[model samples]
Target: MLAPTTVPMPGLPERVRIYEVGPRDGLQNEAAVVPVAVKAELVTRLVGAGLRTVEVTSFVRPDLVPQLADAEELWAGLARSPGVRYPVLVPNVRGLDRALAAGVEEIAVFGSATESFAQRNLGRSVEESLTMFAPVVATAREHGVPVRAYLSMCFGDPWEGEVPPERVADVAARLMALGCTELSLGDTIGVATAGHVQALLDALAEVGLGVERLAVHFHDTYGQALANTLAALQRGITTVDAAAGGLGGCPFARSASGNLATEDLVWFLHGLGIDTGVDLPALVATSTWLAAHLGRPSPSRAVRALAHQPSPS
Candidate 1:
């Protein structure tokens, strides 16, 4: 029998919450039309694997993201478990209105640290897009629903090469001040390295933003998600966002790959004795299920490995 595991680093969070974005961010980029029933079932399986925070779907306009057009249907059919939080992405006041009407308990807003990306993705400057969300954040806070702000292209932008760490921190600080309870710094193009991740966190610290109120969202375009996650963890970050089966990529970011695979992140965290509360075998099974629906193999190495793992008698 193998010996019990111990964390190599001290002062790390005993338990890290795996922010599962499979049902939302993962499927958002799928060209195939995913049924509401399938989306609901995916969320159920993820929660069964002990995922506390699952992004169920997005409230983006149907014309913009037809993949999640059945957001209301999915939410209605979702299995509700005590203590599990199902948050959805809401891009504007209209999205927020629909989410609130559906009884959403938490919501996420998207933005960018770079002006060029902001203009291209959201059709406004970084500052202008931010100003538009002030009322949305305030209204959400009024109803006691927690808000998570996402800053895309935190590390690198396709149009803007090498985003400054301080610029990333500035946008993050602004989001926090806008009544967002937490900020999810997104490596949208997935060009971040371990050193860049560390430097960004350090810059946030310098601006009085503690790791407790921050999360990291990474992609595996260059296969740096796991390494970047470790760097963020070492800096006291407790929340990380990932997509099951490595599904989804940024449509606005050119030549980008899928988001970091939840299975890969789980394997790394469990090996470090960092509790993510995710059952690896079950999580992998969920990914496999979705892969069949997508008619493609999961891009996650851990999912592929676990699917082929021999069952013990």
Candidate 2:
């Protein structure tokens, strides 16, 4: 067992990468159809905030996720920032086709760590899902498009309580073997604790997986996202997935909340002297703008508190 103090907390990395998922994960669950221009502006502002890895949209069928039906139009409209990598979620071959047609160079595929959640989310078994993605990953490699695979419910599942660490590792290993360049472990329902996260990392290590290819995505439903993130960082994991204004929730999981707010994560990282390359004030401004457009108050505590402070003229 690793001692708490011995874990290398190393004062945040020199340059941490933040993958902004607001346009895709954040908006997909919303009932309202956010205008394509609004989505474009949001992505633009995120880029202005220094977020380089933004998930622009999902290429799923309109009948399934109607919110992202304008994937092509939205991707086409965005001003591509030089050096910024814009990736879209592709559920299958058809979605990959659409994303490629829209000129996307990177894509994400998803599967769940639990069987029941996998069945509910993808309507297929875990093995079947991997089989489905085998060709997708191969094709992506063929076209020189990198693939990021998301293993949802890695810590805990709503349908299946307390997912085993070994199960999460197995799924991650399979996805990595399938040619996924990165594997994002998602605490889909926000039920993970620091101890649980450490245990999961230990299990992954036991299977010879390094923290280099791993990223973490956590929800703050239980207010454990940041704490769990810190634990992952101590274990040497770098990349983090977050949404602006805390604007997302799992459509299949009841009462589930969004991924950790980007502003809050940036603030935490800054306080720890980690370099995320993001401008907190600009991020706050963008989060506030997006919250207003959604007709909802900002869910990010950092954004709300910063917005009320008078700026120096």
Evaluated with TM-score, which candidate comes out highest?
1
- Residue pair clashes in candidate 1: none
**Over 4 Å off, model 1:** 1-7
- Residue pairs in collision within model 2: none
lDDT of 1 by residue, 1-313 (tens): 1112555567667888989988888888888899888888998999998899999998988988889899988888888999999999999999999999999999999999999999988999999998989989999999999999999989988887999999989988888899999999999988999999999999999998999999999999999999999899989999999998899887677667899999988888887888887888888888998899999899999888778887755
Q: Give the 10-residue window scoring lowest on summed lDDT in candidate 1.
A: 1-10
Residue 107, model 2: lDDT of 99
How much lDDT does each candidate structure score?
Answer: 0.89, 0.88
C-alpha positional error of residue 70 in candidate 1 after TM-score superposition, expressed in Å: 0.9
Candidate with top lDDT is 1
Give the alpha carbon lDDT tens digit for every residue of 237-291 in model 2.
Answer: 8899999988897887775797799988988887776778988888888888888
How far is each candidate from the true structure, as Cα RMSD in Å?
A: 1.8, 4.4
